[model samples]
Target: MRLNNKTKAGYFNFLGTLVIMLFIFGVGAFLLEYFVYDYFGWAQWLFLIIPIGCITLFYARGRQIFEYDSDGEALNFKNRNVVLFLDKHLSDEFPKYKLLKYDVVNIIILKRLYVSISSKKSHNITLRYDISYLTKKELNDLKFSLSKVIKNNKERKREPSS
Candidate 1:
């Protein structure tokens, strides 16, 4: 599925982050004054710089595009800086790696989350990453392609290994 991060979601994410940061600071400042009995009025506001700066960086980083291709069996991530392939089916081969793919196989669709593929060896959450906003066509195509992979895998018989 070819998709880029949604500009609207990034903006909303920035605002939401700003609001949460403000709330956290407000609470921290209030607690400091009440317990410490120090009347450091307005001085506590300096900490606001931390959240503003961090959110600004995060929002800027979110602009990079991410793409996925089930037919090609690869996902372009890290702001398209790196390519992740989908062919390495675990089948419980590497327990450590499966631990991570537990969350890597999900994508967003129509503002809803869906797991395009998952492992029987891992217990992953349905809700996952927020990047990769997709078109209806792309989403449908990815779903269809993933379903075929899942069906084929399920139909294959297991063999005893040495």
Candidate 2:
């Protein structure tokens, strides 16, 4: 899926909050240092800098785009990808029935909190992400693309039977 500029801005804003928090804390630390450590040593300043540095690095690394594919594969921001194979317990519980294909599941946007995809067979998957990053148009387009992929896959499956 294509990430629009608004998504990028949302990521930046998420990280920006951390930077702002660090700046505020740093200022507070400086004031504390002057009041309590002026006659002592520079140890407090060192302690404060360490946490701020760590927080900045953590946020910088966390900002990225996420991609999910039709086959329940998830590609994270770090470029790591994994296929979500159904577990044996789930498979046994939800035995596949004719005309009910788990792989035919498509993405569904629910309210403002959750995104779910469910197959005709009842197998389902859901993800919770910061959707506030997406504009209405971008979200609509993404949903359309995902739906099309799912529909195509279903069509391919039916073609073998025909």
Please report the candidate that would top TM-score against the real structure: 2
Per-residue lDDT for 1-162 in model 2, tens only?
544342364555566666667767876777787786675476667646766776655443422333333332332211111112311111111111211222222234222223444556776655343333345775576566556655665776778663
- lDDT tens digits, residue span 63-135, model 1: 2233444334443322321112311211111222122222223323213223433468655534233334455
Per-candidate RMSD, Å: 11.0, 11.1
Instruction: Give model 2's TM-score versus the native structure.
Output: 0.35
TM-score of 1: 0.32
Model 2, runs deviating above 4 Å:
4-124
lDDT, residue 32, model 2: 80
All candidates' lDDT scores? 0.43, 0.44
| lDDT for position 105 in model 1 | 32
For the record, the alpha-carbon RMSD of candidate 2 to the native fold, in angstroms, is 11.1
